[model samples]
Target: MERNLELTIRMDNDHVEIDVYEPESGECSQIDAPLSFDEHPEFDAAVGNEIYSWLSLWADELAGQN
Candidate 1:
């Protein structure tokens, strides 16, 4: 199986939007929550292992930071 995800981020002076879109499944997940600036490390030890680990979500965390 092949996984294809399209990421789109839009930010302004007030807010940041992170979107992960999977064209194969027609699924889009908006996965960023509000937290303290200090807690926003962008990448975590779980590396997308919150439920089931997948490399793409890990990439998402990384891409959002860059």
Candidate 2:
């Protein structure tokens, strides 16, 4: 089956944020927002195995840190 997901990554001066959205059910929740690559390498490893792995593919573009 094919599915669509809305993933958001936000960063403030001192905060890093990540939100996951499920359009089918209109449900949303906070996952994890690792501030820097060095801050949360674990989040990176965990997300790599997820369906939203594509989110990481665009991390540079979205995070504006690359």
Predicted structure with the largest lDDT when compared to the true one: 2
**lDDT by residue for model 2 (2-59), tens:** 4677889888775666677778768676656556655667677655555455455446
Relative to the true structure, candidate 1 reaches a TM of: 0.48
lDDT of 1 by residue, 1-66 (tens): 346678787766645566777786687766554433556555342325432444656567668989
Worst 10 residues of 2 by lDDT: 51-60
Q: Considering every candidate listed, which one attains the maximal TM-score?
A: 2
Instruction: Write down the lDDT of every candidate, Cα atoms only.
Output: 0.57, 0.64
lDDT accuracy of residue 13 in candidate 2: 71
**Deviation in angstroms for 58 in model 1?**
14
Give the Cα RMSD of candidate 1. Answer: 9.9
How many clashes in candidate 2? Answer: 0
Give each model a TM-score: 0.48, 0.53
